[model samples]
Target: MDASFVIHGPSIKPGTEIELISNTDVAPTAAQLLSVEMKNVDGRVLTKVMM
Candidate 1:
């Protein structure tokens, strides 16, 4: 069986769900949310979840 995952934070809206996300995308997503730029990341940011 596969494990389910969640990304929770104060800026994130409750009950939001996104599919087909890569584990490698987490870092880039966080960086973008914090107004930090990332270079040469393995995966792209999950922009759909952004406000």
Candidate 2:
């Protein structure tokens, strides 16, 4: 997909302030699972799981 946008504003004088804002929408994706391992003082695999 394709899109375009534009914005306009007025000029500011001395000691004046102005603000411009824009917003966009985005889609979310699925999360991936991973395995984690733990070790003890003897350096041994304790358990593994997906997260």
Candidate 3:
């Protein structure tokens, strides 16, 4: 799979980087940032990027 990305957001720490095992993790990670719950999701929240 060709999986690579450069994500920038207010909650993301500057000059920080992380590796994700699956693209599915994106949805859960974004939900965490907004403090919302996503049903039927199997992805983990990306704690490393949270402010």
Candidate No. with top TM-score: 3
TM-score, per-candidate, Cα-based: 0.70, 0.19, 0.75
Candidate 3: where is the Cα deviation over 4 Å?
none
lDDT of 3 by residue, 1-51 (tens): 577766688888877788755788899988988889898998888788777
Backbone clashes, each candidate: 0, 0, 0
How does each model score on lDDT? 0.79, 0.22, 0.80
Which candidate would rank higher by lDDT, 1 or 3? 3
Q: Which of candidates 1 and 2 is the stronger one according to lDDT?
A: 1
lDDT of 3 at 16: 70
What is the Cα-based TM-score of model 2? 0.19
Candidate 3 colliding pairs: none
Model 2, 1-51: lDDT tens per residue?
444423222321233322322222110001111233322322322112111
lDDT of 1 by residue, 1-51 (tens): 445657777767678788867778889989988989999889888876666
The TM-score, computed over Cα atoms with residue i paired to residue i, of candidate 3 is 0.75
**TM-score of candidate 1 against the unseen true structure:** 0.70
- Candidate 1: residue 35 lDDT (0-100): 87
After superposition on all C-alphas, the RMSD of every candidate to the true structure, in Å, is: 1.9, 21.6, 1.6
